[model samples]
Target: MIKGNLAGRMGRMGRMAGDSGPERVLVAASFANRVGNGLFNAASALYFTLVVGLPAAQVGAALTVAGVIGLFAGVPGGHLADRRGARPVMMAALAVQAVSMAALVLVESWAALTVVATVDQIAAGAGGAAWGALVVRVGGERPAVFRAKLRTFVNLGVVLGTVGAGLALAADTRGAYVVLILGNAASFALCAVLLLLLPRYPVLEAPPRRRRWPVVADRPFLAFTALYGAMGLQYPVVSLLLPIWISGHTEAPRWTVAALFAVNSLFCVLMQTGIGSRIESLHDGGLAFRTAGLLFLVSCPMMALAAYTPVWAAAGLVLAAVFVHSLGEVWESSAAFALGFGLAPDHAQGQYQGVFGLGFSAGQALAPAILTTVVLGLGATGWLLLAVLFAALGAVGPSLARWGARTRPQPAVAAEATG
Candidate 1:
């Protein structure tokens, strides 16, 4: 009876989440891909330092260099998606990543490590571009709903992979590391195979793919991307800044950081898709974004107060802060995905999403330094200012999305321009 009930519930969820044929395929493949990513990231540093015997410093340096080098990958990948279609580009990119990931087991020196890492980084950059293009290709018209479900599944995959990583770490043997690495590579390979099983979207016949960046030419889109990038700072804020502030400046126990992060992650995993599904159109996207800004306004000040509170008070406030912060993130992300996908000309999805990716990427790359300088360098008042900053920036989303609606191309026009 329990098994049947479980199966029945799962079926109902699939229906609600739009897990139709292609959507299910995309979610399955994405879940597989994220599992590999989580496993590799969890093990990569340990694999390099402990198993491969490279110095930890060299590993960090190589990865940093590779990250810098890989920054250029998304734009060209997008153009290729426009020319060759999303599936082929995604499959080829995944194949490259799989090979590169497996090759990590063979690295003995920094030079070799750098080479392999760079190849992997390039593939990752291209793969991310291709992945975005594939989502656009597969989801069609109203993808935010599908994407929300996909993101939720992706988080579940990460949780599963992280558990695998923890078990590997507990085993603490070179052999265990090798298994983890190979297993991650295999997951990537399997995901590519599954992607191959999905329906293909041929490049709609169009004018030669433009070499010029369309996103840059569109001013409102650029502004929106910039603001979206700042909003994305919530990531570093939640992960890095809050933890650092609590440990260094507040009365909260050090372990409290872990507890708070658990809450944040679990909240996101539970609520992200539900929030993401609500963004049906441009106006809905605007409403979500605006709503996100208001939530940020609430959360930011709560976090700021943690600096001086008693242990019990601090712990409770931080929980409240992150709960609000997590919701803001859901709204911001759902809105951004809708806007990012919605604002572009259809033929240029690869390029557009690539550029749109810049917003989030910039936040990831820059937020640590920016947040650290603000929260620590400037002191408590900095928190108040940050609250205002986040709120103000978020407030801009609805209007910007509204503006995008005015200039966004008609579906027929976008289709023909590509033709």
Candidate 2:
């Protein structure tokens, strides 16, 4: 009796492990990629300003161009993915990224860096669509769980990557830039290898009739796309604006701000699954938007308080704000994924993802300038404006969601059968 119980327990554990599927492999790949990406992110600004000696404004301008390139590239990338298989498209994206990173390490001029950055951004967008679509293909019916699993994996990647980057930077921040570039290249190679192991699934190829722009004229789809674009604006505020704000206020060292950001990443890694589980039942788009709105509305005001507060107090407030922001991140991400994968017409899935990604690209392109103008030009006043903007935009999500809910139910998604 005892032996049987032990065997049963072991079998169940093994089954649970296997059920995670290709998710584990993807997670490992993402971890390596993020480490290299994180290293770049941690040091890139310094590299440009200190080593490359480019003006901050110029760097910003180049990023804006990169965003534009990424936006334009998304549709073509998706089309290519649909025409080719996701696996092939993904491998191509990785190869582009790897080559670009290697060139970046050797390049001496800002012009070359700008070109590489733009091309890399385009590759990123293409790769992103293929990856997300592939996940949907592999996930079968449990997409939410699958997405949650992937989110956790990505977050775990962020944590490890950030830690590794931090340590590398600490050793010799200036010398580490080359290593950062190399790290990113390594990730691409790793991802390419792992992708080969993923089960073969039907690829979305271009339609028989071509020679035209992809159409995304559906009203509900447009609305969803707009909401996603608006929400994407929040990322720059967090990444670019918030750090500057933290530096100006409070005597806390720079590392403190990095630590706070790290906390956000850590929570995303640990709590995503638990949080995702509870919200799985609330599939209504309107509810998801409302939830996101509440988080932004409640958290944005906390930013203004950072200037007046003590170090510990400021840290606490920032931590709370980050946590709230992450909740919205999870909900918005899940909602966006569901809408992109599930809501689009069966024949138009690739087009839907492409066009919607265009919206994201638009937001990404515009954010650096608009956000910088508001936050840097106006100071704390701009942050308040951002807060209001987030709240208002979040409010807009529900109306869009309601419209979607009222529309005819989207047809069930058919999983591609693996060969």
Candidate 2, superposed: residue stretches over 4 Å from native: 1-20, 52-59, 173-175, 204-215, 249-255, 277-282, 310-312, 375-385, 405-410, 413-419
TM-score of each: 0.92, 0.84
Q: Each model's C-alpha lDDT?
A: 0.81, 0.69
Off by more than 4 A, model 1: 1-7, 207-213, 410-419
Model 2 TM: 0.84
Model 2 Cα lDDT, one tens digit per residue, 212-320: 4444546877877887898787776567767877887655567766766776677677776655544432234456666776677666667667777888788778777
